[model samples]
Target: MRQRIILDVDTGVDDSLALLYLLASPDAEIAGIASTAGNVPAAQVAINNLAWLELARAPEIEVALGAADPLEIPLRTTEDTHGPHGVGYAELPTPIRRISTRSAAQMWVDLVRRHPGELVGLCTGPLTNLALALREEPDLPRLLRRLVIMGGAFNHPGNTTPTTEWNIHVDPEAAKVVFDAFSFAPPDRRPIVCALDITESIEMRPTHLIRLAERAGSHPIETVSPADPPEARSVASNPIIRHLTDAVRFYFDFHDGYDLGYLAHMHDPFAAAVALDPALARTRPATVDIELEGALTRATTVADWAGIWGRPPNADIVVGTDPVRFFDRMIARIGDHARALYPGQPVGDPVTRLR
Candidate 1:
């Protein structure tokens, strides 16, 4: 059975890669894409959505814009990671399509209501949209099949701050609201929270990019451009890919600065991968909570169920990753999908061999 999913993303580089993987995968059907303010503004997020649809050639799928800021504080954008455009440095032809009339939060609520127990919600950004939807439609959670979120820092040091992950840090109140609403139950009703430590540990080395490029061929560039031919569109039309490509290029620059060229963390893609194929991810039951109040620890997520820490585990936490095996599997799957989609394209030698 194909998994029916609605991707709520900030269109970060890794988020773009995840979108690409979904477009290539055979197990899922993207019901819609809802954007929220995070890596970029809500407006740009809407633009990124159009770019993605143009690239993926799947404009038929619904795309809706969501919240511009948190329910409380003013919005904060991440130009350092995703670039000024929120998609990174990669440029493409202007998106030809306009956004759906409905807002992302409304679309989410409606989708869940209509689908009823068949929709898997994949959220890879700030929790604003999800929180708003939950607040508006109290019954939405009961209708959802499952929810996969990519945010929070369990045991590891935070990426955005010393104690919090970016998505949660952006809006801990929103995070708390959503987590409070959703309940996880092992293999069935669990809300999979892919944290920073786990995802950062899963790196997309130069070898993987080369493999992706090889498989993707020249289609990626053309696909991302709104003016690209219809046949060239697919997952590449995903703004997530455009942003990812931009981020990869930026990462390359950072790598060069530090003499570590082309190495990039899988981050959002890894989280999406776990949601797409949980069998590939290793997880354990642990209590998790978002720390709403603390001068130094604001927005931090505490995960320590029993002997680990006094804090009870609120949600199932993803802690470990089989890096070597998982990367190989991801590369294999992406390559196969790329080849099938863009045949006769040259899969050049990997820029750097996988370690």
Candidate 2:
């Protein structure tokens, strides 16, 4: 049976790729998508989700809008990291599909109850929506088949503050609630935490984009460079290739600006892959908690890796993975799916497709 999943995203550039990764994978069956506040505002995130589904011509999937703000703190969005609208330089068309009437929290609660013991929850954004859902349905931790979260920095340099990751930093209270609630989960069902320590290693350089475009048989195979004008857009023949190229290019530029290099971290998509196939991750079981009271370390993920806490491990923290294998899988699946959607030059002679 295909693994069933509900994705909660902030629709950041990486989050957009995560959605595409799930759609491209034959083994995944996306039940719904929740748009939460983080990379951009919740409303804009919902719009991006709808726009992407339309652009991909994907099967109809419910897109639910999450709370306008975080659980406690004021909403914080990183438009500089992601573009103004969260999707970087990609300008996807507005979708005709309407957002679901159910709020993101309601949608989460409803879907998990409907597919108890079968629905996998994947959160590539803040834990706001899931925390709200947990409040509505206290048994969610037991009902979910599994949960994979892309947040935290755990032993790695923080992407937000000196010690906090973006997702957790945005809503530490929500993150705390999630970690505390899932403590009772069985060993097999503990949340798989894909923190920055591992995700930073899943970097996507400009060459990876070229490989993806070429794999999809898109003509004028793309090349992104640090010297390219920031306003330059992709002209790849395939629509998917064009948008992804544009999006990843912006991400590349963002990283380079921070002296991190001209490559983007595939954080969300890596977590998405582990959600479907846990074997993709190498995890270390730990009692995980959020630092809510720290003056300078608030929102930091605290992993008791040495059993000093005397509490059961609530999270299986990913510490290692082979990034090369992941990029290979990403290129193959997304490339094939894109080619199928917009058939381009055949295997060798990159031409154009006309229905």
How well is each residue in 1-355 modelled by candidate 1, as lDDT tens digits? 7898889888866677677667766787889888888988888887877776666565377778988789888888877776677655666558888888998999999999888889988989998998999888977767888788899887788878887889998888999888767543334666888988787777666455555555445233321222222222233422433334445655444434445444666677676677777776667766666787688998998766574765434466776778887777666666565555445654343242111
Model 1 accuracy (lDDT, Cα): 0.71
In candidate 2, how many Å is residue 25 off?
Answer: 0.6
Per-residue lDDT of candidate 2, residues 90-150 (tens digit)? 8999789999999999999999899899999999999999999999998999999999999
Off by over 4 Å in 2: 346-355
TM-score of each prediction: 0.84, 0.97
List pairs with backbone clashes in candidate 2.
345-350, 345-351
Total residue pair clashes for candidate 2: 2
Give each model's clash number.
16, 2
**Cα deviation in Å at residue 194, candidate 2?**
0.3
Candidate 1, residue 122: how far the Cα is off, in Å = 0.6
